[model samples]
Target: MAGALLSTPNRVSLERLVQVAKERGYTAQGEMFSVADMAKLAQETLGCQAELLCGGLGGPNRDGVLQHLITGHPLLIPYDEDFNHEPCQKKGHKAHWAVSAGVLIGVQNVPSPGYIEDSELPGLFHPVPGAPHQPPSFPEESSPGAIFLLSKQGKSWHYQLWDYSQVRDSNLQLTDFSPARAADGRVYVVPAGGVKAGLCGQALLLSPQEGSHQLGLGHLPQLNPAH
Candidate 1:
């Protein structure tokens, strides 16, 4: 996948995608991708068939949806009406891309917040865990969790996710901070057990130490099992 991304054509397309994002009021640091934008990145930019898999509305599949992203699946989560201040709430939904840079992180098109809102914005969407404060503009609701996964089956491509219970069913546990390091010295975590033997869990790693873009395939870190 990394090789394909660096290929001249795909690299050019990725640059174009970034340019389009910049034109849409997004910043060079991070950007939001609507369902349509995600589709474009998958099909037109990445050249893969993309699907928007939702875990339904709120809570239930939260862990599963998160696991998908943690394991290298690409996803885009849209904020729901649950985000908003009184009276004028529920007016709109905003979304951001879920990037798996060894570890899963959410990238926003808007700026970071100054204070924490009692809402779900900082809790669920921010790249790093913990509340920095309420976002300047993104007050999102508890998301149902939406993600995109790509796989090549036979002659074409397919997008899929864990069957919601596979993580627990497989007895897979997440090691938030794995000790193994990537070629770039970045660390990531991988599941020790899987629903089936020999399953390759996505190596969830730490975010970049410094940088604006953290979702690139520049470093495909080696996976280190928790066990």
Candidate 2:
């Protein structure tokens, strides 16, 4: 699905992609798809270059994601499924992949103080009768912001709005899949138990073979941050 979204002017079928991956030996246990596998698929099927942006301590951080998005490159983010739902009867961690659509940064309104007297000129300013002397100020810190994710549920794909913290935690908590490249130069999946390490802020950025096609800020819709 993500490949299809990124491969504009060219259409790619999921069945063909699976067939190609199987032929290239990119799948795990001949069925599962890993981040590396997907990267290889994107490279071969879409004629795009793949770059893995991984953090030192965790899966890709918020800054890395935002930077890739700013460059108009959509990301393939794999994370722990527990981040989205409460643990049920499942035993081990389950990992899921999603495509980043965009981010949502809320617009903060700053109230006016109405009027104030000038310190230098005594009669230069006048205060409104009902206006407060000073209006409340917002904090200097930047908002963490939320993200738009294109994810699959059951057999259908949906767009979800998730808090950036959830995405960050999920990516860091992944413990079911690890990236690995086989001897044949195929990116194969390594069992998390064998590796004994999580993805640690890993994400894949897909760029066209020609060059990056940047998305203007005007193309994104204005939305409030998710609570």
Candidate 3:
């Protein structure tokens, strides 16, 4: 006789499938299908209790809504493939804060007309939001955490960002002046985590010292554990 269950999956059966996945790993490609399928897969595979998988490829195209990945457990899903806020020039329907944050950091060194930049950054970083006229020029970032503030770029939120490592030394306390660094350079500080779906865990950032612009958790193995 076959070992696997043969009957249709009930709520209990389905949850068990998900639980087994959690103990082993959470990178299953899901039931292998469409948006609804992806959503269901997120719910089961990522253990999101109730998955959304919103925005971009597997989500709705609505503005001002929080495009979450799942509802229960956390999963940091990247809404955009390129992760460009505003998508393209003359086409940004609304501001995507995640993109905007990276844009600010990316264009930190561009020579453009705008608010005066801090002497330390010269023209690298800014505090205000950009308009269609003064669109941001995001060259790149080597990590994803720098854009955490803007991750909630949708109307659902407006998160305050911090570079705690920029402010504190190894002690994790505010110092008069501390410039200690992490391997990834700057890490965005939040109210102790749990920002939103697709951005709950720390979204790693680019290293100020390194000349890289890669972010997003590197691809997880596709069931092939022996990498």
The runs of at least 3 residues in candidate 3 whose Cα sits more than 4 Å from the true structure, single-residue gaps closed, are 1-53, 56-103, 108-111, 119-123, 127-133, 140-227
Lowest summed lDDT across 10 adjacent residues in model 1 is found at 80-89
Q: Tell how far residue 86 is off in model 1, in angstroms.
A: 19
Clashes of each: 9, 7, 13
Candidate 2 lDDT by residue in tens digits, 1-227:
56565656578877777788778876644444345566677888877767655552123244445544544457676655554442111211455556775544332443346545568965333334445444223222234542333333223345666656666566665554323323346554553433224243556777555544633222221112111
| Predicted structure 3, TM vs. truth | 0.20
User: Candidate 3 — worst ten consecutive residues by lDDT sum?
Assistant: 63-72
Any idea what lDDT model 2 has? 0.50
Question: Model 1, 62-84: lDDT tens per residue?
Answer: 44444434433443322211122
Q: Summing lDDT over every window of 10 consecutive residues in candidate 2, give the lowest-scoring window.
A: 218-227
Clashes of 1: 9
lDDT of 3 by residue, 1-227 (tens): 00011111323455565455445443242211122333344344333222232322111211111111100012222222123331221111111123123222333445455445577855454433232124344322334334222333233334333222221111111111112222335442222211222221112111111222322222222211111
> What ranking emerges by lDDT with the best candidate at the front?
2, 1, 3
lDDT of each: 0.31, 0.50, 0.26
Q: Distance from true position, residue 77, model 1, in Å?
A: 2.3
